[model samples]
Target: MHDPEHGDGTSLADRPHRRRAVDNQRRSAASADQVHRAMVAVRERTPTGWHAAARQHIDGALHAFEVEPVSGCIDAVACLIPPRCGFCGWRVQVGTYRIGFAVYRDGGARVASFATAGDALGAAIRAVGKEIAGTAHR
Candidate 1:
């Protein structure tokens, strides 16, 4: 038989080399199978594998929204919006209304009356929290 690693003919003394080469081939095949199995397991466990589950959740939510499209690929919805001043800069596509502002170093005041106690408290909390946290308040 022809040998791959060694091209010359094998003698009786070369039996050990042939055995070692076969053993190495078996080990290499086993290791390759192990690596393939590991990659499959990782793909099953990672976010890339969760597309079906995420789509099920999104579909269920969208079904309740009166009418919505259901034919788009999952990757179509994965998007990033650059941060911007909603008042002056281009609006983000996530929502219809522009609801952001820019602030000067010095404090500025902006307010609107609320119709209910809950709404008033929520607005107050948001405004005060933003001021204390050094951010633009709505």
Candidate 2:
């Protein structure tokens, strides 16, 4: 069969398909650059003094890389807490229908729970910065 309507002779190589923005190597480099930029921005925007601490804590355990289903994913994080308090670690309640992050300060008595660990950390950074700068009341 000639199959003129099928465009069989129209050349299969010209078939429509999504064109890549950049070549594989360039695309990979661009992606990596974007991730690094995001990480740096997040780190920088985080209050002030806490930037160093947060970077130290998250850089080691966090894999700021791309995933199949989710283009970019920040999977798993580690924080280096002071040895003064022995309560620094992943916290879990025995009988609670809640899940999120729990932050404790001043001998682990004052606890603050957040919907997500990122939020908790962000709040901590901002709180500390504000307290130090004396602009917290505002």
Candidate 3:
């Protein structure tokens, strides 16, 4: 005779499964709307001078990175948004100067400056997405 329950009183199947992509390390959890908007920002392709073949290869890989299970990052775009701030490790702020917006990383060092908040945030999002995409493939 044998017991289905382990000595610890819990079975292996009783453990809660978690998505590796959205684990607490990825900012607790993001709402579906938040994830969708972030996906739009992540999927945007910035113009680059690459051969068509290379671009196609990269695009396919990116598509896989954005698919179900992972769905890319929930909020890879970090910004002190007017409504709410996205937490993506990187820090961002809309500045008060001739330059409108900027991103910061590694302890207050400025990453970039943009004429518009949207541009700054988009660039940051694209960068984060690119990094995640690269890791997802390799």
Candidate 4:
């Protein structure tokens, strides 16, 4: 007979699997929220200009990404910086390669990739400087 709650022939045997799926979704949502909050705090604290803001964003995201998760392994170092000012946005990815870095800005309209973290960071700083200059001129 069909179970009233499930409305199907499935029985208690499926309960464990369903519970696991729900738990996984909850964990994923919580993780995303944690990342978002960290990014927002970074943005709020860095309001002088895009260059300073991006620098703070990069530092904060890197710290959050380095934190160990409750389960599994972190395969990449990546973080998001929500839009702020007219000139700041970032998708910074480091440690993706054994010795490389990648970054996107202006909502991914601009992209920079590098073979070393130092080079990538320098490029990012330059990009932020340009953005700040452009905004100042406007």
Name the top lDDT candidate. Answer: 4
Whole-model Cα lDDT per candidate? 0.31, 0.34, 0.35, 0.41
For model 3, residues 24-58, the per-residue Cα lDDT tens digits are 32332232334344444434532332111111123
Tens-place lDDT per residue, model 1, 17-86, is 7887676566455434433433433234333222211111242121100111133221122111112123
For candidate 4, write residues 16-114 as lDDT tens digits. 776666665564554445445554444443334232222333322322222111222323333333323242333344443234345554467565434
Ranking by lDDT: 4, 3, 2, 1
**Best-matching candidate per TM-score:** 4
What TM-score would every model get versus the actual structure?
0.26, 0.24, 0.26, 0.31
Task: Point out the worst 10-residue segment of candidate 4 by lDDT.
Answer: 63-72
Worst 10 residues of 3 by lDDT: 49-58
Per-residue lDDT value at 102 in model 1: 24
Alpha-carbon runs more than 4 Å astray in model 2: 1-110, 135-138
Clashing pairs in 1: none
- Cα-based lDDT at residue 58, candidate 2: 38
